[model samples]
Target chain A: MYVTLKDGIHDPQGKAVKDALSVLGFNGVEQVRVGKYFELDIAETSLETAGPLVNGMCDQLLANTVIEKYRYELIEK
Target chain B: MYVTLKDGIHDPQGKAVKDALSVLGFNGVEQVRVGKYFELDIAETSLETAGPLVNGMCDQLLANTVIEKYRYELIEK
Candidate 1:
């Protein structure tokens, strides 16, 4: 699962990126925002098992109950 | 950029999920892991501009200097 700060949230990391841009001489840069990513491995071969399992992971662990939100995609290897 | 703990690292959130599963009567559940996600809107129209810019965002802010790793994909609206 991947979790991130929802839109309209203050992002300290994004602020730092803006600051770095000015330092790197990248002028006219206005803003930045950051988020999270995840890659998961599941024993199940079907979405029926994977979807609910992953969603439960998101609700229980991948996302912060206070501010951030989460989403995920399953990849088959 | 989306950032997450490198594999083999202990994930506290994953641990919590395991705990929750047991509470919720999911006895066979073994593990859980979490990560970050981002959706970016860029003024640029090409990968040449978007790629470096997004990477800079990742290195400067989106990812922690220690423990986590990150990757991202571009989405067009």
Candidate 2:
């Protein structure tokens, strides 16, 4: 699951990123926001099965889905 | 970053796992704790450089480090 700040949201971490960029001498870096990327293991045979399982995981467990917006991609092991 | 509850810690999510298992008719499943696994894109030239950067990311932003323990692996793009 990749979790990020929705557009126009206030992000303290993103502000910190801007601060860091200035310190690092990277100019013209206007904005930055932090997000989370998650990889989960599912006992599914393929992406089709994994999709619903992962979505359930997100809806029921992984993400709040209300305050945060998340998207995920399944990778085979 | 992989974020998980410290050993012996109480996890509400894990309890949810237990509940789900029972609902799913899976017997003898005593415990389960969900964790966060994150894959990040780095601009580093090598793992050596990426390691410190990732650790910095964990410390500075990604994981709380104080409450949740986290570890990460970098995948080249």
Candidate 3:
């Protein structure tokens, strides 16, 4: 799952990174958006059951939907 | 680029999310690791020129080599 700040919300951390990169001589960074990456291990193997299960988790906890948006891709293990 | 804490560093945010998920009765979440996801837009187009450019950025600013490790897949836009 990847969670990112919404378009209108400013990312200070990303701005800092871009500035620091420029100071370090790595240029041409037009834009940078920082986000969260989650690698999860769950017991449910079937996508049918797990999709809603994980989505429920996201709704209840992982993402703060008011200011942030999340997208996920489930890969079978 | 996906930047993650090296093993044994312990991820408090991940643990907190897991505990919250359990409290919400979302079970079977065995493990969770939280990391940083960076979406960068740069001027360079060719892989040959851009690979090292981005990697240098990671080495210098994005990933703290002391405790975090990073991997990236170059996707042409």
- Tell me, by DockQ, which candidate is best: 3
Per-residue C-alpha lDDT of model 3 across residues A44-70, encoded as one tens digit per residue: 979899889878877778788898888
List where candidate 1 sits over 4 angstroms from the true fold.
Answer: A2-45, A53-71
> How do the residues A45-69 of candidate 1 rate in per-residue lDDT, one tens digit apiece?
6877888877776676557757887
User: Using Cα atoms with residue i matched to residue i, what is each candidate's TM-score against the true structure?
Assistant: 0.62, 0.51, 0.92
Evaluation by lDDT, superior candidate among 1 and 3: 3
lDDT of model 3, residue A61:
82
Superposition error at A67 for model 2 (Å): 19
> Model 2: per-residue lDDT, tens digit, A1-77?
66666667677876766677557544444455566545344556687876776666556654666666778766776
Best by lDDT: 3
- Give RMSD (Å) of candidate 1 vs. truth: 3.9
lDDT value, candidate 2, whole model: 0.61
**C-alpha RMSD of each candidate structure in angstroms:** 3.9, 6.1, 1.4
Interface RMSD of each: 3.8, 6.4, 0.6
Error of 2 at B45 (Å): 1.2
Q: Give the Cα error of residue A24 in candidate 2, in Å.
A: 11
Instruction: Give the DockQ-based CAPRI class for model 2.
Output: incorrect
lDDT of each: 0.68, 0.61, 0.88
